[model samples]
Target chain A: MIKMRLLNGQPQNRISMADRAFQFGDGVFRTMRCTGGAIEFWARHYSHLEQDCAALGIVCPSASILLEDLSRLRPVDAVLKIIITRGETARGYSVPDQLLPNRIVQLAALPAYPEQLYQQGVKVRVCSTQASWQPALAGVKHLNRLENVLARREWHDPDIFEGLMLDRDGFVIEGVMSNVLVLSDNILSTPKLEQSGVSGVMCEVIFDAAVQHGLQVEKRAWTLDEIKQSDAIWLTNSLMGLLPVSDLCGRHFQSHAAQLLLSGALKQLRQKEKFAIVDLAGMTKG
Target chain B: MIKMRLLNGQPQNRISMADRAFQFGDGVFRTMRCTGGAIEFWARHYSHLEQDCAALGIVCPSASILLEDLSRLRPVDAVLKIIITRGETARGYSVPDQLLPNRIVQLAALPAYPEQLYQQGVKVRVCSTQASWQPALAGVKHLNRLENVLARREWHDPDIFEGLMLDRDGFVIEGVMSNVLVLSDNILSTPKLEQSGVSGVMCEVIFDAAVQHGLQVEKRAWTLDEIKQSDAIWLTNSLMGLLPVSDLCGRHFQSHAAQLLLSGALKQLRQKEKFAIVDLAGMTKG
Candidate 1:
């Protein structure tokens, strides 16, 4: 298997058993798409990671060193998985007076995705398992993900591509791992990440693209009822770009202009990436 | 440090990086007290572990083999930690079809408790953090414990022994890791595990002891108000036999009866343990 190194700059095949992430799910992570030896949306992804680490009191990894490391490991095209844990060797829950937080960066081959599904869209299931809201941890891709794991385990059919999740209060938080956005009245509305939901890397890109492309974005409680009248439903994450939904819970929707435009924008971005790997060397972050 | 086999009974220095438990808090655990080389209340601990396994669909460890391993790893007085994760590999939100669920059991030197504190009592702080209610995982000691981990990090003082945790809806749930009980007017009420709280081994022992001793065991929602008015407040767990709380949020209580009685009963049971271990000689769980 291809490998990676711990942030201490050690060549390691395994992380310590006592790592806070391994011990208590005390960590946050980001999985980004890297093509032509360049990562997509490096600034937004690292910024979200820094914000989450700050919120959770995890030490932030320096972006310059991280980019340099990733540059070495980047293949022609691959997926980069970065995990920043609350460090190893913490006794119980007490954050040490001093912490050398550990970061792990792994390069892996991107899983094959159905390109046609982006055009035809995918089907999703509404899981009975609900995401419990913890305002302290909401919107961060923190490692405490049992709710998503439980929801994902509810079904085992390859036919069901993704599962949409809601917080215990019945507000649609997001998906098991990705962010959710629904279109209605020519306006695109995404669930607010203020209380709960992973503020995904791709979601930020879409939000930025929306503003640049003259599309409006709203952040509010997008309930299951709002889901019914929605024009188009789509899921976003770094790996699967933007996946439109053809059907959700047996209800069907047709193609829309925004979807095609969004798809085209992503394609253009992909093509732009093919030429120049945009600089992350001077990006400001925590 | 001494280490036992992995959950799947494989030998490993560290658990897999992709193990679901480490990744998503997708597991359950039981902590037991070993006196004279045998865990006190072994059957009840295993039963609770099995209950948690069933609740989360994790593979239950073979009781006899598990116990036998425990017997091998015990010190004359020790603390045993049995963490049973979902036994599935790390695949983000997905629990893959092929799973070799893992159990990691480790025995450490028992914590030295202030024997006099049991007689005089300890004090507690009411933490501002609140536990989220999730009925799907209520009562089980599953590892989605960011709440407990967060609260545990709230304080660190030898003088300040424990902290009280409340649910988001304003009901007292438990201590960071132990179960809580209050005594008022010849009636004892413990927070209902219906929503969120670890159904602890020692908590179960005390409940059984209370029932056997003809005490009213009311399991329901308990609030801070009821606790302040309680005749006595007590904490129960394997590591802590029974700790009487002198005060909670500055309100003092004289809750020594239930605490002493429960401790005395458990002490008597631990005096003879060779014959007390669970008889897994012929039982097959899987």
Candidate 2:
């Protein structure tokens, strides 16, 4: 899945040893999907990147600069990862007065996940590694992701598509790399990331579409039993899009009507945003 | 303060942007003090590094390899930082079948902290940023230190030497960059890092010496109120050694006898180790 990489808009594959991201993981990143040379939800992704960087006190690179870098790649049907680090500075946690954030944009082949899993839904297990509670870092998607790495390492079963992680208080927060939504009757609920978990962009887009679809959206702490009791469970990410959880432990969530409804809405949203970008052609001219 | 950097073993100053350390903070690190070209408590530091790597499933570089790299620098009165990452691999959280850990050894000038701070004690304020609860990650000096970075960023006042952080439960944890020890009468107490916090090597040495000195050692959770009522508080790290906190949120700690006693013991330990290294001269030949 590996391909080309650009550091600070140049065709470079290495960063300074002193770079804060390499040294302290002082950075934020966005993993976006680009199809037919057009990135899905470009505006929302840039906005989220800015917010995540602001949360960490690192200056966000301008959208034009990132767009220019993206244009350089002219990615077609690829996974685009944009990382903005606090840049290289002296060895310390203290943010330097002269903030020089470095932008890294890379392209990789879209992962070849089996289509049958998405169609029939996937099987996920509850991870033993619990998520840490950091209200400050919660929902920002900063680079301090060792917890997720550890959680993902729990199972090597190719049969398990993803792992569900809970906060220290035993509240189910999110999937190892995806945001989760629980469906019951007309209410669509997801865990509030105020104390932990990354507030994913795909989850945001889904919630917006759900509201327009006349679904009552609820965001709060979710217990494991509550999750299991739901009519259906949907895991969403920028790359994977959306996948229903058919089996969690021994319980089977056979109802996937909610997943189909949201998947169609998500496709509509992606197409609408693609047509809305005035510079779509210009974005690839570089 | 950075003087030199060695990536892997050679004197290189950059690493692959795909390195796990930069990519996901998938790494562990050690910061040690090198005086007279000898790393203080080298054996203990190496053991801690091995344990931390094992905790995160990253392979630890053998000590002789690291010591050989240190000898290449021939560092004297410098601060040494060693970072071991899970190495570069294809994208995703799944641990690859093959693991190639990368070692980064760098040298920075020994911090020139104000001399009087150790003698008269320093003033510290409680940080607003709370340490996250990650029992699995606790005590490992991994590179996912955005918590410490955010806590340290809470204040820029040079008058305040450090900031004390509390866990989600409002219990005193540790300094933003050091382990904290609370002294009340004959009891030398420190927060148990089982829930959250990095267990500093210097704190370990102090506790060992404290036991030998006939002081009762207790490790458990300590509340803010309990910390304020302590006789004196000391912050310990590899480089800064030990510093007493004379004032915390206006509560004064007049006792310095405990700090003095520990300081003496630490010096003796360092001297004892220096004489114990038979390869001290050979180590610098590189």
Candidate 3:
């Protein structure tokens, strides 16, 4: 696979040993999809990155600078990962008097996923690892992702595509890498992420699309029992778009109507001029 | 200042961008003081590192291999930092089938501290940021330390030596970078770290020393109000052995007898044949 990476806006594949990201996981990152030389939902990704950086007191690089850096990779169907770290420090938790934020952008070949996963959906298991409830750091895609890493380690079977993680209080929060959606009685609801979980970009797009389609959309806390009783279940993220959960903890979900509706809306959004550069061929069809 | 670093037992100063430590904070680390070519409490530090790595399912490098790597640094008065990451993986959280843990060791000039900090103590303030409660990760010095970074960011005053962080329920846990100890009457108490906080190596040594000295010790939950009513407070860490907290949230403390007793015990420990290689001149005298 062809790999292209930039560190501090320069082509480089290595970072200093003292980089805060390497030391304390003191950073935030965005995993975006890039196709035909343009990024999918660049504006939204940038906005979210700004908010996440602000939450951690990091100075985010301007969109123009990041765009220039992305352009260095040229046109490609790839996974784009951007990491903004608080840069190198003199070996302590305190922010240095003179701080320089490190920007790392890497483009790699798009990961191949089994087509059947999108077409027939996937089975997911509940993870024993509970997400920590840190309201101060909740909802931001920061580098402190040990919880997600640990939760994802709960299963090794290729048959299971994702693991659902609950908060310390046993409230269903999110999937290991995606935001969750539950549809029941014409209502589209997702977990409230104010206490835990990352607020995924695709989840926001789905919420907006649901609102545009005259659907009742709600962001509230739900229990695992409530999730099992939902008519349909889906997971959303930038790379995977929307993946319906055919089986969750032995409770099978049959309805794909809500997933189809939201994915169709996302497809339409991709066709708009702002996102026209995205190559649909690069994405797996559901 | 002379600096020496090793990556996976080889001389190197940079790590691949794909290192899990940089991506997901998937690692554990230890910070120790080196004097006259010998690491302070090497056995305890190694034991803690092994336990921490085991907790995160990362294979720890053997003591002989790590000792050889440290030997490359030769005899020096410096600070030693060791990081063991789960190495790199294909673009996700799943652990790779064939895993190789990355061991990084770095030696740098010991940080200089004011003699007054050890003698008269330092002032500290309570941080507004609350530490997250992850029982699985509690007491282990794993790399998911954004909470500590955020808490350290809460204070910028040079006079304020450290910030005390509370857990989710407003119970005082530990300082941003050190374990806390409260002295009230004849009792020496520290927060129980079963819920949150890094169990500092020096804190453990102090606990053992207190017992040897016949001082009554207790480990339990404490609040800011209780901290204010304490006779004296102190912070302990590997680098900064122990420093009394003269002021906390405007409440001043005058007793230094407890601090002296503990420091004296540490001095005796340093005199042992096993620790004879340590250089007493390099430390700040209380």
Candidate 4:
């Protein structure tokens, strides 16, 4: 599908090659979902963007400016991507004395996935590519995502939806594109991203929903064996929402009541945001 | 100075916002020095680029194609940056079923530095930021350089020529923009990049020069304390060739005869490549 892009609040398809984003991946980005002409959890996404920019010392554009840029797009079922870079610099890692952050917002048709996979759950594999330890960049959705790209490249089988990545120390960190959650004995535990992994927005929503539903939530390190021992496993992200994992590294999991509870809570959260459920079953071809 | 850029063999200043280089840093790059309309170490740089692209499974552009693109620039004295990305993709980490790599080559005026730096050496500091361990990406010079950017940001003092980065285990790896070399007991040693750090082309040249000059060379892990005990230290890169380090973290070193031997050998290596000496003393302003 053709994509529409806005560069710095203008309808443009290209960015300067000098942009630090292209040069050094000196930036942060967000992949957001848009439904019924409104962005889902936009305030949360913007807050996260600001926090990430602040972490890198990049000046984030004001929310009103980004809102106006988003408003310029034609309201349709789509995915909105926001990239904020440290603008252009002359051949150096040091930030320029005077710098302006470049903001890019693009809209593309929502990717179609097999609806059956969502219902039956996806099969995931453990990727050999390990996420590196960088506490300063941990939990921020920055654009230095070659690790994710490499992890996703590990499997090409259409049957597999995502690949789980472990840290160098063999601790289950996250999925290539999503955050992982494990349920065991009425508790919801997700990997602590203090050292690595991207702390996803949907993962945040799931944590809040679990707390509201009176489920104990623990954020700590989990080995692959420990994760496989869970009563249920799921991956959460902004676009995919919550997708239960049916199989991980040959270990099978059954859909449990806890899955439904969290799913129902997420549905209510979306409904409160006026997100109309788009029937994606018809669009699932592959 | 305004920089001239070429995208996909065409003179262009911008790249598509969807370009994977800007999105995920799914690419590799080479920063080369150009003198009198000839690119220095073109063969070595191209070979490294090909190796890096192959490492990521991206098709490397033919040497002839890149040469044709580089020839378009009116190369006075400049730094030519070549970035090859896995091209544009939809909104995901998975490589597309059909993919085409994008090549970007740009030229900018060479940055001027104090001539005293080459003679008296530079003061380097140990960065608080540590390089992550990712063997998959080790020595490739890929574009995911947020780690370098963060390290560079850790110091703004003009006196500091470069920041030394250690691996997660506190083993000295490399400088932010250069490779680290140590001289001890008439033996030259550099940190092994098997686990991390960019395997610089100039570092390779220095190794060859050391062997030609009959100097002992060792590639192994060395701690910061161990590095300080060295007779002398140096940083190497394509642009900055074999710069001696007079002071590292306030530990001063006298100019040793071993440094002069290596420096003279490197000078002969450059002369063999027909790289004319450009007097940069007059250009040093700040």
Candidate 5:
């Protein structure tokens, strides 16, 4: 399937040597989990992609075209990555007068999840690495992720699990690649991303779930002390769904309310969430 | 000449879909200018590239191997770019236990320089964008350069010229891609890069020249307020050599004792500097 896919896309592989994305880290991407026979959160994923592309003034490709291309590699379920970068430029910073962003989408097998760890949440710790404050680029999932790369490098403990990151101002931001939610005073609260943090897809699901269930929700600057004192804490992401924080540096107390809410939501969603196979040949090249 | 260059040691026609450079910005690159068949400052360029690769734990191709690829290009004088990225990762951040970093050496004709602008000097302005302080990555030239991209995006005023960047704490650091030196009270000073900024090769030369010419040379933190009062300011880089800053925003400066001494030394060295290109085929690829 992979060989044939490459052979067919040969004609559409005309990337100019001076595209700004290749020249500068000017792009955005989305990695969707296609399970069963449908794309998980397809609307939300493309919405975020288009929003970010527009924020950076890059042209976006049509979603139906992308869907058409994805129809070729149908094999139950797979992982799909879509990249849209600032298009060709004549070796300069100013985005050209007329812009047609280059879009490249690729497909791969879904990574096997560590189901054992998910049953009993993995050990989590706080990382020393801090994301710099940049309101100009806050919230949207842009391709400039060196902060996450550096944070991901902060740990090598195989026995350990996901680590939380804080901003330079000491505000607990989010996880290495996931979103965080705190159940404090019976309220669902997450850190605000006016300065920095990837606005996550899973996070939107959690928020919507809270709204439908009539749970009080809040979004604002959150400190480490506040998070530790919260009745319960959980991490959220499209890949991991939702995992309750069982142990934070050995201060273990199963936030009874957190366990109830997180478990209930995960159970309700997992029952409906399914992955689909992607057809690589049908993918459109921007 | 570039089309013949192979990808992954094969006669590939385009960049691979799985190249890590495209996926994660996981790479390091070096660009050098060759004049009259010889690459100026080859040793300095190689040293900086090697140090960065070592710091990032990226594999380093031997100088001989690099030259062999260069010899294949056979350009009398050209702009060469060397990009070595974690080649074919399987769609995740975890670098494989056994990884083979890919090496790409591209040669292009050099663009014409504005020598007259150098002779008359140029104007520069302080950019609103601030550089994030990453202590671990302060002095190395890695592929992650969004800060430079953002700062450079501030203007295209050919007359406005380069923009100076300040650290989060508002300390004068350097230009978008060049280092700045200020002269006052018969002393020449540049900002230290222990916390941020690329330690430019030209900066080291100017520091040594200051000592040889009997001028006080300083490297430490100073605010924009201090820089505004300097008698003379200049920008230095491997490509631009040493050029004076005639106008900084609303402020104008004239030649000073320290800049005079530094300029005189650079002029004499350029006259005596011997540049000889070695056969690229002679380079080793360990």
Candidate 6:
């Protein structure tokens, strides 16, 4: 399938070299699954993108403007990515007075992960590379992702689906590309992103669904020892939806019980949406 | 004079959107001053840029290739910036097997700062935004500079020349756009960048000159209180050379003594360089 790329609504694959995003990674992006010509969880994605941009003082492009750009792709069963940059400018870190935000919309083939992995769960490993401690940038999916790239490079084993990252203080923060959660005593606990980690949209959705299913939810710091002792562990992101961690650092977890309960709650939420679903799992229609 | 930008030696301003630098800031850069068609400290600038790229596992372009690119610019008394990105690739963080680095050379008009800043020293304020700690990327000047952008946004006062940044642990790091050094008693000291901050080219030069001038140099953790009590403070960068800090956090400092001693030492060093006789001020032939 041919991929589609649009820069500022133009069918272009190039941006100015001096663009702040190219110069300093001064940008934020959203990756959403586009199914049957409609974006899944688009509202949640846009809201997160706006908040990320606002955290860096970059003015976000209006929702209508972005939606218009998405429509231009005429996407169907594709992975859609939207990038909002502070725009092109002269040299230096101080923002220019007259700011023009750049919007890039791209469409690619949807990743085809084996269906069995969703049911059987995937294996993960702890990364040696630690996440930087920046409270100001925590929870915002900004473009400065060198640490994530480095962590993702630590393992070459195809069986290890992801690498979990810890902050400098040895607190479990997140995965290289997704947010992580641990289940213990029926309590669903995700890391507090006030000091590190990207707070994924799906993670928030899982928290809401877990609450609806009468489960305790906690957002706080977690250590490697605490995670290893949990009843179950899960990894979440927009594209991959959610998956249980069958093995993490040689420790096995059985997440079938909690998965069924929350999956049902998520299906109920998906039914209220506009898109027609073929299969509903973990708040994502696949 | 018109600014010149060369992408891979081609006089163009656009780069592929898929370039890793535009995507994940997977790149390194160097900024230097050109005087009468000759780049100031070209060897040191290239060495630092190469080391930074190596730290990130990128292949540094040959010096001959970069020098040729600079020669194409026909730069005379301008600001030159060199950027090397890990080329272009499809989505994801995994480094592709086939790698090609992209080189960008840009020449811009030299900034015309009031000479009084160099003569009487400049006032700098302490930034509220703290630098993140990532030991792996501590000294490398990579493109993940959103923190710098955020810290620089703290002040808009024209009189405030720079902002001093501290790490998350409250240890002095560097300036928003430069490296900082403090002189106390008869010793010169700079922050240890093993856990935070960029180890700039000019900062290394200042340390060497301070040592040759019979002044002791120290690199270690420094607190705001300790910095406030120092005999004098200074900021260093490739473009600005070195400037004394006259005022910081409303406290005035007398840097005249240190400035006279170090500037004289730097002037003697410049006399042996290839560049003709000019105003040799703080290792910069301005």
Per-residue lDDT of B109 in model 6? 94
lDDT of 1 by residue, A1-286 (tens): 2345444544454766677776688888888888765777777778889998887878888987667556555345777778888887623566676787887777677778877888888888888887775666778788888778778888888888888888777888788867898888878888887766788878777776777789988888988878867999999999998899898888897877798788778777665543223343223221
Model 4: which residue pairs collide?
A: none
lDDT of 4 by residue, B154-232 (tens): 9878888999999889999999999999988888999999888898888988988999999999998999999999989
- Candidate 5, residues B29-76, lDDT tens digits: the string is 777766666766667777888887776667878876776666565556
> What are the TM values for chain B, all candidates?
0.89, 0.96, 0.93, 0.93, 0.87, 0.93
Candidate with better DockQ, 4 vs 6 = 4
TM-score against truth, every candidate: 0.91, 0.97, 0.94, 0.94, 0.87, 0.94
Kindly indicate the candidate among 1 and 2 with the higher lDDT: 2
Report the Cα RMSD per candidate.
4.0, 1.8, 4.7, 5.8, 4.0, 4.9
Consecutive 10-residue window with the lowest summed lDDT within model 3 chain B? B277-286
Residue by residue across B196-261, what tens digits does model 3's lDDT show?
889888998888888999999999899999889988899999889888999998999895788889
Q: On residues B1-286, what C-alpha lDDT tens digit does candidate 2 reach at each position?
A: 7899888889999899879999999999999988877789988999999999999998899998888787676687888899999999779888896789999888889989788888888899999999889988999999999989999899889888889999989999999998998888679989999979998899999898899898999998999999898888998998888888889999988856777799989889887655223254464553
Candidate 3: list runs displaced more than 4 Å: A273-286, B273-286
In Å, residue A142's CA in model 4 sits off its true spot by 0.7
Query: What's the residue-level lDDT of B3 in candidate 5?
Result: 27
What candidate 4 gets wrong by more than 4 Å, as runs, is A273-286, B274-286
Q: Residue A245 lDDT in model 3?
A: 92
lDDT of each: 0.75, 0.87, 0.85, 0.86, 0.71, 0.85
Interface DockQ per candidate: 0.50, 0.85, 0.67, 0.66, 0.28, 0.62
Error of 1 at A147 (Å): 1.3
Please tell me how candidate 2 rates in CAPRI terms.
high
Off by over 4 Å in 1: A1-7, A268-286, B1-12, B88-90, B272-286
> After TM-score superposition, what is the CA distance of residue B9 in candidate 3 from its true location, in Å?
2.3
- Give candidate 5's error at residue A220 in angstroms: 3.1
Candidate 6 lDDT by residue in tens digits, A158-180: 99999999988899999998899
List model 4 lDDT by residue over A1-286, tens digit each. Answer: 4378888878898898889999899999988888877678877888899999998889999987877677677646788888999999877888877798899888888877667766899999999999878887999899999999988888889888889999888999999988999998878999999989898888988998999999999998999998888899999998888899999989998877887889899988876654222322222222
lDDT of 3 by residue, A21-103 (tens): 99999999999877665678888889999999999999999987887677666546788888999989767888876599999
